[model samples]
Target: MRNSRRNFLQQLAVSAAAMPFLTFEQQAYTPVPHNRQGRVLRVALMGLGGYATRVAEAMQSCKRAKITGLISGTPAKIKEWQAKYNIPEKNCYNYETFDQVKDNPDIDAVYVITPNGLHHDQVIRIARAGKHVICEKPMAINAREGQEMVDACREAGVKLLVGYRMHFEPNTLEVIRMRSAGEFGKIMFFQGLSGFKIGDPTQWRLDKTLAGGGAMMDIGIYSINGSRYMVGEDPIWVTAQETKTDEVKFKAGVDETIQFQLGFPGGAVASCLSTYNMNYLDRFFMTGEKGFVEMQPSTGYGPIKGRTHQGALAQPHVMHQTLQMDGMAEIILDDSQPVVPVDGLEGLKDLKIIDAIYAACATGQRQKLSL
Candidate 1:
């Protein structure tokens, strides 16, 4: 055993010597500036699912970014996107060959839109490829995995951004601005309800192993996120109750509905419900000492509308996803911070809350957040 350990150490030392030293200057990862003068950011889409397709369209409208590479498991989908996006045949890559993308100077970043379970591996791989990463929501199965991805990106000197569309929406941003500007006096409470009747039993969303959890992991995340933004602070503690309507339907790890409450730092409280057994009621309501702000159907695909106690907001009139993509491009290229918080840290906070929620549900007791 001693000899084997020594051999392993010697091999590791030799490998370390073979690798180039990473200096402080070499460690700096410069973002592409938003100006039109520089080269356009060449992005690669790692998954060709529905969300990936929508992101591709949004990228087309970005003046500073474009899809230059495609990675997909399905050969048919690869051929289709290659033709649609005018991606060169040489730039197309399968799952096995995706690591080779590190050598392709044309690809500066990668977007991972795979299933929830696949996010951790894909993000780590992309970060190792020395490319910036944009990942779909939930970030990972849990906070631990999310932190791993973040650490990997930081170590690789790459930028990591989560796909949080509402952070970039005009109406949502206005609400945040109003709250921060004291339009709403001394915020008091927040209420969020996000649910959808998921009909497909065979869908990956219903599978516990693939999805990590049920409605909470899927549509329920919107509630978790809405509460954080609406309250304008991370929750100090969480209490939750869960109900499984049909064990046969929801399965062992699947939850049909969950009611969770959050206690914020400044004596604020948020009540939220997330489910897969109900109709769409995605909304966010925040009440302050002055009045209230409400967003009906807040966390959906497009055309999110809202009004504050002051009055109706002036809509920017664009797809929420589109705005998010453009904003991400600006952050990557222009070194801009999002007006509303949507960084990896923000996403990680949400995941921490999620961890608490799951624990509360299991124990039937309130759980305090450590961070």
Candidate 2:
């Protein structure tokens, strides 16, 4: 038994020495300005999917963020991004070869824009490589996977940021500011409707294995996340009802539409809907004692229209992805925290609520959420 333990320790020591960045170097890392110029946070795109393409294009408008590396399973896609983004061959990687990214100095972080189910493994791999990770919404299939990803990144001394783009939007932040400033005068209720007519019935998003759930996992998460931020409190209980209009399209285990009610500790209540069959139905409404705030097309890609009982929100419009990348760059390189957090724990809270909502729907009872 002693010999076995000694051998295991020796192997662990060898692995640690092999991966130098896995040391306590990240703990000692302080936000150092590169020069008189702004800090640069070099990022690598892991998946070359549609969302990844959008993020790469928007990253061009970011001052402190640069696409310095590419990681994709497709060789042709990697070649295209390398040429288009001016990424050197050495900085490019495939999924199987991505672990070697720790040896490269130019890449500072990996953005995991893969499917919902793939986030857990890919994010852990990025942390093991000693790089920060920015995973897209629905951080993982469930809270268990999400927590594991969080623990992996924490152990690695790396940051795990979720791609909650709405958290960085100017108008949304303004509304949050108003609520914090007592403009809302004690929040009471919030309503979030997030859904779209999903295309391609055969896509992986409809697959339970890859997506973990149906419409709720894909677009419904926006409503869940929005409610938490708008209410400024975590939910204590959830009661949900799910409906499926098209069994063939949505599948048995997946949800086509779900209406959920969340009860908060401060007596605030949130009613939300997540669906795939609905069209042009992205909106959020928050009503308080003093006033109310409403946003139409709230979670869309751009030009989020919003207004309160006070007046029109005159906040300037910027691309959501652009603002999100720039804000994330500051968080990474400057050690700055955003007015609205987009960290892994923040993502975990949403996932936990999702788990409870699913349970509530299954049992036809109000589910308790300890988050």
Candidate achieving the largest lDDT: 2
Q: How many residue pairs clash in each candidate?
A: 2, 0
lDDT of 2: 0.86
For candidate 2, the per-residue lDDT at 69 reads: 94
User: Which one wins on TM-score?
Assistant: 2
Off by over 4 Å in 2: 1-38
1-371, model 1: which lDDT tens digit per residue? 23433343344345445657531111112223455467567889988988888888877777677899999999999999999999998888988899888899889888888888898998999899899998888898899999999899999999999989887776775676566556788889999999988897889988987888899988889988877776677778999999887888899888899999988888989999999988967889999998799988698876777788778766666766667776777777676555445667767877888888999999998899965
Question: Given candidate 1, what's the lDDT at residue 182?
Answer: 66
lDDT tens digits, residues 326-364, model 2? Answer: 888888777765656789998999999999999999999
In order, what lDDT does every prediction score? Answer: 0.80, 0.86
TM-score of each predicted structure versus truth: 0.89, 0.90
The clash tally of candidate 1 reads 2
lDDT of 2 at 365: 98
Q: Which residue segments of model 1 deviate by more than 4 Å?
A: 1-36
